[model samples]
Target: MKKAIGKAFLAITGWKGEGAPPEHGRYVLIAAPHTSNWDFPFTLAFAWAYGVEMRWMGKHTLFEGPKGWFFRAVGGVPVIRHERRSMVQQMVDLFTEHDRLALVVPAEGTRSLVPHWKSGFYHIARGANVPVVLGYLDYSRKTGGFGGLLEPTGDMRADMDRVRAFYADKVGKFPEKFGPIRLKEELEADEIAAAKLAS
Candidate 1:
């Protein structure tokens, strides 16, 4: 019934999905090029259409009020942004607790253009021992859905290279508001490479 509603919603909005959802029962599902508020409902719509009971992390404050249960009912997991590394650990622990979890992480962290993506998704996938799946929104084509599956090799650059390739052609609703698909951790990868050359 919910899947039917989701599919109808997408059809009504004239937004269609591209590929099938990932087969992994437990993994980090990243929604990329997230530059607009509309991404939330559309992402949810796709999840329903694909039969993925996807859970997303939202600001903890959102879960504090009377509507908290509503949010949780729709698969929202409250997160305190300032917790940083601890938040990653908590998400990893959640994966341990649930036998089948599809956590949708918005890598951009906000609607505006950002310099780099938060690395928490990468860390969570690695720590949870689950593959990372790319969920994309290409407003240019009026299409969006899961793209590629990446198994972390602990080599940040190599793993991210696969991520980069998948999103290269994905365009956001606000194209100017979308920055490069990069993680701040890649800078550390750069430093490691530089050090090896110097030594």
Candidate 2:
């Protein structure tokens, strides 16, 4: 039934997935091109198609009531951002408890463009000693898949360079949009720094 629903959904909307780990240890899944809310369902469907047990963090409020049961059944972990709880700490704790887990985290934190990404995903992987897999939703290709796995070495700028290179030339399906992780202020800063060094 899961495969049927996933196939039917993909036939209509389309999806392509790759690089999904097969029963791996604790890690983080970073999905990008997050330019629309549609990304959530599409990515989730793709994950289902691939038979991956993905866990996602949602606001604490979303985990209460009948709807909460649905999310929990799907492995949703309600997070209270207002509790001053460190996301990285929570993830480390969860990973310690689970031993083997794949947690989905969106670096953009939203569909809208922002100057600098939240950077929490990077921290989580580094702190938890886990691989950070790059998952993506590319509207242009009508696909969603995981990219290369990155093992962050606590070097933020250098790691981000590799990340930007991976998503370069990717396009978003939405009008006036490119890749979700592209064209940020940090990219501009990197370019300027490189130019200065070259000069």
TM-score of each: 0.91, 0.84
43-117: candidate 2 lDDT, tens digit per residue: 778777777678888888998888999998777988877766686788777888886788998787777766657
lDDT scores of the candidates, listed in order: 0.89, 0.76
Best by lDDT: 1
What is candidate 1's lDDT per residue for 85-193, written digit by digit as tens? Answer: 5889889988999999999999988889988889999999999999999998889888989887889999887888888888888888888888878899887677799
What ranges in model 1 sit over 4 Å off? Answer: 80-85, 188-199
Question: Any idea what lDDT model 1 has?
Answer: 0.89
Candidate 2 Cα misplacement greater than 4 A, ranges: 175-199
- What's the lDDT for residue 175 in model 2? 34
Worst 10 residues of 1 by lDDT: 78-87
- Model 2 pairs in collision: none
- Prediction 2 global C-alpha lDDT: 0.76
